[model samples]
Target: MSKNPLTTILEANIFNGTNYNDWLRNLKIVLDFENQTYVLDMYLPRALPEESTHEERLTFEKWHKDNRKVCSIVLASMTNDIQKQYDRHDDVRPIMPRMSQIYAVPDQHIRYAATKVFFDTKMIERSSVQEHGVKMLYLVEKLGDLKADLAKEMYIDVILQSLHPSFDSFIVNYNMNGFDKDLHELINILVQCKATIEKSAQSVLVREASTSKAKGKGARCWRRNKGKTESTTASAQSAPVAPLGMGKGKRKAVRQSLIPKDVCINCHEKGHWKRECPKLLPNQAVKLISANGLQVVNRSRRLRQTVLKFSNGRVVATLV
Candidate 1:
């Protein structure tokens, strides 16, 4: 026996209370493939009476058989729950329409829902502008299917309004130019705008990352320099001083080594030599030298004093 064509083909989607439209659409494809779609269209001839002519009788009988086969195919595709509701109807025409009415949403309700979805949809941060625009278009198509009166401008507005703030500039320019664009044109513009925005955002992120890295490096360098300065200061304060009789060369070398490289030995300030230091007056310079504990070896002088040693080997006397 030949395999049943219905069994050979992939089974149509079984109606499950809902999804009547999708199920019906798939069922039509199957029926069309099997050359049994005539039953749904009510084109199949009815059975003839006994008094009919021989040719007429044969034609009616063949159509009757085809009609019954188509009806069985439709019934087989339905789930048990949906099948029970329309199984009493032997003709596919009445059965299909009745099932559609029972399961499909009313036209008005679909339109209302589509309108609400179209207007209420807003772009979220997680979704790109292209994704948001696509969703808007899908809702517009749904409305169009219901014969809803939606103008091109209205749809463009809907899509534009649903966009995230990232497209603010585009929106402003679009409104300023009063550009009249159809759905396709608007979608293309939105796609390009989204690409530019994403690219700009990526560039900004890269710059910020590089800037942050540079700042971090600078902070680390500053911290390292500060630490070296503090350590040098602490070591200078803690270092044991050599006896007074130590040669000027050895004493000067030890003092210079203990002091921070940036600090001046004469004025104890940074960034200038003692000779050119404006802050160090002649008296202040003498006091600074006396504070260093350098005593002058003068047996003839009754008063004890300290001497300031310059880098050029010049010595100046100051009373302690």
Candidate 2:
């Protein structure tokens, strides 16, 4: 065996029961660099030939040595549990295929997962459109790697559909113009559209703030006016009630009404009850003085009328 002083370790991520494809690719690259990849490609014979040449023996010995190295690299990359499963194998070729059987995902499942990424990804609140566009492109690239049957235009459509509703008009404009855009072109257009949307959103917020301020001021004014009206009514109600029959030139402000609810039995004038008339002295029947200085007194009777007499003995004033 030619010991060509190979010192390159497998510069690969550890395979923790997942990421089998990545780990496998890294393993191959490292093995190829070390000239040990043939150990994986060729199958070993059950035993050395009985009458083999020195060249055949050397080939078997070289293969056997490289196979051990490859197996060592594979086991080093796997987790403890997974390494135990493949470490028993003497041939390096079967180990890789066997590991693949356990860890490698099916093509259909990978395709489903990639398709789900396209549908599940979206531009959300407070997220940048540039980031959203870039992410969408990345997923499309992944799908392409998996040989997904989506066309280039379908990639553009999927990104547009996944964007926020603020881009609804932008999408419509894109479709109406019928422009063919690659992923990068779409991303560039979205960046510009994002700026426009943000500018318009700022302007709308300013207008809304102004409108709300106006509404708030109007509401305050209305409440102030309502309070003033209530205060005026309260002041008018609590003001002193004056005597009835004020002269037009000397009248005090009348609040509700000068008349009481009960009829005046003495004057029969309905302004107040029997003795409560302003014309009566306290504890006296209602009395009115005639032009001749004679006093007419009222004695309340069931009859509604009382007659008055003057000093000249004439029936001058009659009250009913």
lDDT of 1 at 293: 46
| Candidate 1 local lDDT, residue 285 | 72
Q: Model 2: how far is 274 from its true place, Å?
A: 38
Model 2 lDDT tens row, 1-320: 44323323333377887888767767777777788888878887857979999999999998898888878777877788887887777667788787778889887898899899898898997799898888888889888888999988888888888999988999899999998888999899999999988999999999999999999999999999999999999987887756677864345324334544677777878656654587667435323334223422333442347677888889977766
For model 1, the local distance difference test gives 0.76
Q: Evaluated with TM-score, which candidate comes out highest? A: 1
* Prediction 2 TM-score vs. true: 0.57
As a whole number from 0 to 100, the lDDT of residue 16 in candidate 2 is 83
Quote the lDDT for 117 in model 1.
81
The CA lDDT at 103 in model 1 is 84
Q: Estimate, for each residue in 1-320, the C-alpha lDDT of model 1 and write its tens digit.
A: 25456543326457677766666667667667767666666563455577889998776676677777777877877778767877887767677677666788788987887798889999998577667777887888888889999788888887888888878999999999999888878988888888888889999999999999999999999999999999999997798787889998898877776655576677788875675567667778789788654544343253555567779988766656
Model 1 misplaced stretches (Cα beyond 4 Å): 1-13, 29-38, 48-70, 87-90, 240-320
